[model samples]
Target: MDLDQLKTFDRIARDLSFTRAAAALNVTQATVSMRMRALEDLLGTTLFHRGRQVTLTDQGMTFLPYARRILGTAQEGREALRRVERGRVTLGSLRTMVAPLITEPLLRFQEVYPGIDVVVTEGRHTQIIAMLHEREVELGIVCWPNIDPLCLDLEPLVVMRERAPLVVSAEVAERLGPRPGIEDVLAIVPQVISLFWWQVEPDQASALCRRARSSVELPVEPALRLVERGEGVGYFLDSSVREGIAAGKLKEISPPEFGELYRDTALVVRSKAVLERPMLRDFALELAKDFRCMGRVIEDRLVEDVERAA
Candidate 1:
């Protein structure tokens, strides 16, 4: 009938002692007894058997589970209220991967849940996964292949996919000559500006890096700019260099060692997370939405690369 009386009865049933339950509940033993008596009166049944020690009678044992369920429901309702007031969310992302993968989905989310505050932490792919394991962040936008397959508690939603193109500047291509062998191309480049990746297939890029005369790791834009200046050969997402390739600023190079290059970007959450706020779940879905070859830079560039290579 009354929540307080039900709560008291549940605690007393669990502890099997009114004095112990009262101490646990921060109430006097008299108050606990009174609430238990009121609950028993409402139910019209004797709850506990009292002889030498306190123990639940048949009716009390029957009511125990139901009381626990009610208390659980109440706790959930309270937590939901607190979530509405707090409206906080944290996301982890790689420093170089945040541009097209992160921007639009967040814009769409803000249009709907403007009151919620989103904080982002930028780190390497390994660091972001570490943040998830530590429960320092609620969600991560990461390259899926880089994540360890053995990790059991990760839930990944593939948001978008783009091609990784092995590319050289037009000047570099001219100097190296048309359709040069992989070894000749490898010899000419003094420095290879490698870009950030989740490293699902590290061997593909690492092999090239190892074979090249020298290598420097850089982010997407800087890598692209340096490659355009003919600093050396580089790998870039097709979308990142689509405009350059179309405008004759960059050229695609195919080497024998590399095969089938693509990267899947994902929104990752802990498998055990409840996602109590709709904003969190909806944002993940938004990132996962299917955006084909129209406005998306990745799709547009992929088509161009295919036609040019054809």
Candidate 2:
């Protein structure tokens, strides 16, 4: 059927309610119902069961995947056309890292190369590497672990330390009185830490044993907020928490025993693929420089600001 009909069906299936689907699609409930009926007639199969509560039928269950694939293919086709009209780059990353570094640079790059399109996708560490391996995406930046067999290049980047010390709320700090051991603090505090930190030195991981009851794996922002609200402590790249630390929403809870946790950040792609596109090579170089600059800028500013306050 028509694209609109496909769109309508997808929305309905997702929400499982025509009324809600219509609202989401900016159409009337009746319009949604009518579209589904038309789609069913064209396909000669009942797509949904009509009752007090709307539900997908066996036929609808079978059609769902095909319908989604059709819609996805259409969207990709449109994006491909747009890329041809204008050069394009597809980049993938873990969402936690995207906002601070990748997003702004991509936006700025787009301004310079207005003809170039940048498509960004967010996935976890493993998924991102798999995407890169498949060449589904031109580039991906991820925490340095599980590097695939592809001839990919890597660069190291660090989070700048925050100027202001992040502090727990009065209650939290008091809950674990003076000079609480890492294990004690961890037992009670809510903490967010990167997955790679565990790969650091055992002492470093052991040090956190007191500060973290158990590892809490979450996207960076939410974890920071939880720490800010005194839900628990969070471990983030020094750079990611700069804004939060500056605003006095968070404080550094120094564990008496602590050490450096390094994550090897890299640009991943097939080495041979680079030979084909000069622009691609240029982009990779610029991206590395940008990451370095951002880290330094934040560190310099943080040190200067903290020293001035001192």
Off by over 4 Å in 1: 1-86, 145-151, 159-161, 290-310
Best by lDDT: 1
- Tens-place lDDT per residue, model 2, 180-250, is 66666666764635333322324555455444555566666666666767776645666676676677665
Off by over 4 Å in 2: 1-75, 78-82, 145-180, 187-203, 206-215, 294-310
Per-candidate TM-scores read 0.60, 0.60
- Please write out the lDDT profile of model 1 over residues 185-294, one tens digit for every residue: 77776687777575554677877777778899887778888889888786777667788999998998876656747776656677524344566766655655533331
